[model samples]
Target: MSFEFVGKFLPYFNDGLIITLMISACVVLIGTLLGTLIALAKLSKIHVLRWLANIYIEIFRGTPMLVQIMIGFQLLGKIPLPEFQLGILTEDLSRLVPGIIVLSMNSGAYVAEIVRGGINAVPKGQTEAAYSLGIRPTATMFKVILPQAIRNILPALGNEFVTIIKDSSLLATIGVMELYNGAQTTSSTTYQSLSPWLLVAVYYFVVTFITSRLINLLEKKLGKGYTK
Candidate 1:
């Protein structure tokens, strides 16, 4: 409610926002790459691969992300990793690395399903046509199938990115200093609980809203040349 209060802490929030974006970006990159591989594994002819992928998807999807982050923090702490600075972010690799890994694994489970559904939605005839043209299965999947599947899943991927932006807040529990953590810091410093949280809520809404609109535009552009 106090514009002055909000203005005073804007820099703190901005710093947190930068960390939030960094975490989200890293998670999206790792998750999408991991998820694509999992999706392919799930669709593979090898039962062992499919089974392992299913188990992975199930375990991650079935658990709370908060729990996963906690577990990751504990487990990854045992590994001795060299710490380094990355711009404005923390130099402590322990929290940062584990938080990103946990979130990426969690995101990958959901993204795998999204990608699998998208791939499944593609007409079976496309694969058959590729096969008839003497294209190998790998070529058909990578060259023909995945391109169409990615187009179909673009909107869903956009939603996932937005989800990551919001979900990155969970890293605050591990002291990664993202938006939610920023809100906590501001709240404690200003001794105004409601306003700090409210500001971050507004920040989240703005970021997610703009992201969604950009995704909608992208979907429209991509949908232009293709039918269905």
Candidate 2:
């Protein structure tokens, strides 16, 4: 394997890689926050809220993320959405925003289910005890139920984050041009015997491995107090 192309291709993708990392981070953070909300809604005592959350989970999880990205950024932008005029977002936000939105929407579905499972795994007595102690329903959820639920679901959440990291490659299809895009461009320009592709693969592997390790630590910490 000729290693000379490393110097040639790496610089070209350096900026793009930064953008990719930024995009992935945004997707994870935004997705997790939104997902937690949806999860709570799905587990709500109100049937209406549960139904709404279920439908949302079904639609996003059932749809292809690629289709979502294309429709969200290109088609929807052309059609002019009318709900909110949040003013123009930034250059980075343009491609990255839609990508993040689509991914967060998609990931939220699975996350909701994971969170629900975590909630179920929590001892039912805990909720009852919170109620007996005069904790409001909302307070019980935020302070007692959800916190424990989140601890249980940390592993699943990490797995989803890893999935999102890999799935971020889909953004390139819409011209977001992330790490994979940078690799493609470099490979085409240099005709560089697969080195660029290999490098991109290595980068993903390392990042994912580190993420998995961190998640492992979280799971261990949670496991100390919980069963799953």
Candidate 3:
């Protein structure tokens, strides 16, 4: 509200914003990779692969991400995990891993659909031409189809990245200390709930706004190359 409150609170919010960005970056990278594989499975000629992919995509895409996170986080404690030699990844890291996994799994389902649509958008003739030239199916898909498909879907993927940023706040429920959690901490400590939540909301808006603009510019650039 007031400039003084803004000055006092911005630093705490910035710290949380950084963590949110870091988590989103990790989620997007892992999610996009996993999603692409799932999409490929969905498109594969193999029946079992397609069925498994469908199951994964359906379960993840159908469930709420928050529920997914809570389930994963709770299950983590019950499972026996191997200790890491690095020791850097201790209890806190253990807590974070589940949240990241949940986010990636959730995002992958949506990204799979985007990727499949993008792959389908490529003309049939292109695949036929690649086959005619003796390109193996895998090679054709990886070398030709995927590249073009990614270009078509880049904007959607960027939007996914933005969405992940906002969704990362959900990790706070499990104590990830992301933007929302940071605000919650501030509110509890300062006893001024409105100011902290307001600041974090502004932070989310700024991050998403900037990200959307960059995505738009990238879409335009990629479009220029593909125009007939």
The model with the greatest TM-score is 1
Per-residue CA lDDT of model 2 for 1-228, tens digit only, reads 566777766754666666667777888888888888898898888999999999999988888888888888874445433332112211344555677788888887888888889888989899999999999989998899888888778888899999988999898887665778878887777787578888888888888999899889877876785553
Question: 81-174 in candidate 3: lDDT tens per residue?
Answer: 5433211111256667788999999999999999999999999898999999999999999998998997889988998999999999999888
The total number of steric clashes, by the backbone 3 Å criterion, in model 2 comes to: 0
In angstroms, give how far residue 183 of model 1 lies from its true place: 0.9
Q: In model 1, where is the ten-residue run with the lowest total lDDT?
A: 83-92
Question: TM-score order of candidates, best first?
Answer: 1, 3, 2
TM-score of 2: 0.87
Error of 2 at 4 (Å): 2.5
Worst 10 residues of 3 by lDDT: 82-91
What is the number of backbone collisions in each predicted candidate, taken in the order shown? 0, 0, 0
Taking all chains together, the TM-score of candidate 3 against the true structure is: 0.90
Off by over 4 Å in 1: 1-3, 78-91
lDDT by residue (92-168, candidate 1, tens digit) is 66788999999999999999999999999999999999999999999999999999998889989999999999998
